[model samples]
Target: MTHGTSQSTSQSPAPTAPGAGAPSGRRPRRNKVPEVTLYFWIIKVLCTTVGETAADLLNEKAGLGLTGVSLLMSALLAVVLVVQFRTGAYRAGVYWTAVALISVVGTLISDNLTDNMGVPLETSTTVFAVVLAVVFTVWYRRERTLSIHHIDTTGREAFYWLAVLFTFALGTAAGDLVSERMDLGYWLSAVLFALAIAAVALAHRTLGLDAVGSFWIAYILTRPLGASIGDYLSQPTGDGGVGLGTVVTSALFLTVILGLVVYLAVTRKDVAPAQEAVRHAD
Candidate 1:
């Protein structure tokens, strides 16, 4: 799904990092993002689950309220992103670390709005959805493509991360809203999202859904799906979870993510073919 040049056909070889276009004889770096694969989705959902539980863990255990946890995670996310942007090519450790941190920050953002600022989940969900839409609109208008395969430029990377952040925030809010209104509890909510993602995949394969659209849709759905799974595992039995607690849930998912990242790093299977580079506007 990520290999085609369906989004843009006129890409040229570009410097891998910002301001690295000097007349050096060295070869340009490869893409900074991972190629979409089964590993990518697995790690993504795991990170999303970690995001859900890790945020709660910090808020409850660190004595940092929602606001404090948000600030702390956001600072860490900023630091990791700086390091990520400075790296010229995809590094599994750096890239996945940033993703995990961002997931926590994203969940915290939604929580603060709901628990701290008294904003309703519906309003936060709507606001985040609109913000995400604006980000995509501006990104496409400026870059002319939304394909992750082409995120070699700093500008595109910025837009991509911004969209990712909002997607998490939106997903958190929407998940809470749906679970509460429908009274489906955590396991059932997880099942609902799982089925939704399956339907999206089916549509993409058989009903002519475009790759980018299918990807983003699945991406957004995974956040809530992961959140539901986390909640189901972590919350008390009376609360419809298995009572594993946030600490266990977070640690469990993080371990899986670490193992997957290590495997991907060693195998290098998620790196795209250098010849199938991202197509960017001139």
Candidate 2:
């Protein structure tokens, strides 16, 4: 499951290059995001899986159809984002909570487009891809970098989360389109995306792909990979799933996410070096 070392920049933007200290007087800011670690990717994929299954659980069992479930998750996501923004540094609990909520909201967004509004997955996928590109274009234009390491400022943090949201939405649409069009079952779809992620890693290692580029590409691919896994576990067997049901799948993944977040909080192993610099500086 592990790919590279703790210092692998291929997983994320290279953390503040060695000894690149802050200027004369101003205090250094801690990055809002965690350092890319084995734990980071593990928890990220789990969160995406929970996002898919939990949304379905709510839609089917909570008596809240697509629209109702969408509104409920969206409101909760807004509240979590507010709390996340107000925090001074990367709080593992709050940060991961916000991510998990945003994942559900992203799934809902894509589901609403496809199931409620009768939009085609093809159209939604293309639209979300374009929107994500625009977000990145504006984010880079304004901040001069798309690297997560510099997400210490409110503006950069905003851009980061916005991009994350679109990635999940895009992944959902793209995953569904591919699975249906290619007649691939949930398991096969997961494998396909997993292979794509592997290729991206290979490109980064051998072909000299940019760190940020490789990270974001893998990040987007994880969404669909996780979603396909979620579907495979939760859907009925006749529907090409194991029939474990969404409740079981969501609970399983959420429990794993909670445990991993707690571990990261306690160990602080995933804290970015830049954030550590800020801490030591303070």
Candidate 3:
């Protein structure tokens, strides 16, 4: 997917001293989000790559053109999101499907603005970044927290998904901007974003940065990283890519995503326990 990301563990929830969204003595809510594990990142990257190449495949091979592809994918994304919202807790297959679809939709949104509407990549990138910042500001002011571990309520999940959508759009625009401006080949662009994410991880672990902030930053960074990887592998050799073609790249990544989703569904490795303690500590 063009844009997506999140964290490792969660703080347990509170026992309801101060009233919030729900009342006290309510049944424990399950964490809607998954654990921030290695598997999570791997699948996430696969999703981003799939989003990129798959969108290209549909647009070019399917002959739907950009507008048709955008509308079709957006409709499919809306349907998947509905199912995702209906789920009581994290289900790898459902969640990743939503993510992969959202990635495609997000990319399409940006592509439409740039390719169809004649907007510059720089303008779209800046616009999406500002919109994402405003969303984060509002989400934090209302919920007083941005941690993925505590997203048990519909409101929180809504904010989370909204953020994910913007990240994808922004990543697509910004990734294209950087790659084209610097004249850096896809491989170099990938390396650059990978290093940037590593710096975020290092900052969070060693430089006293907030975990939630670091996680979100890294999450957004991964979008561009994955996009670069997709372009590198899918574009022609003359265009400085590995020449795998969009279909091959999309299918390969999709297959990997499918395998991971099945593995997670069976093992439940990504599911984090709902923690009442985490809420209280905060």
Q: Which is the leading candidate under lDDT?
A: 2
Query: Which consecutive 10 residues in model 3 have the weakest lDDT in total?
Result: 1-10
The regions of model 2 sitting more than 4 angstroms off are 1-28
TM-score, one value per model: 0.89, 0.90, 0.90
**What is the Cα-based lDDT of residue 48 in candidate 1?**
96
How well is each residue in 1-282 modelled by candidate 1, as lDDT tens digits? 343223322342344454544222233245678888888889999999999999989998999778877888899999999998887778899999999999999999998999889999989999999999999998877666677776766777888899999989999999999998999989999999999988988887778787788888889999999999999999999988999999888989999999999998887888765533532211
Every candidate's lDDT: 0.84, 0.85, 0.82
Candidate 1 residue 204 C-alpha distance from true site, Å: 1.1
Clashing residue pairs, candidate 1?
A: none
Q: Model 1: runs farther than 4 Å from truth?
A: 1-28, 275-282
The predictions' CA RMSDs to the true structure, in order, are: 5.0, 3.9, 4.8
Summarize candidate 3's per-residue lDDT along 174-241 as a digit string, tens digits.
99899889988999999999999988877766775677778778778888899999999999999999
Best candidate according to TM-score: 2
Sort order, lDDT high to low: 2, 1, 3
lDDT score for residue 168 of model 2: 94
RMSD of 2: 3.9
Worst 10 residues of 2 by lDDT: 19-28
What is the total number of backbone clashes in candidate 1? 0
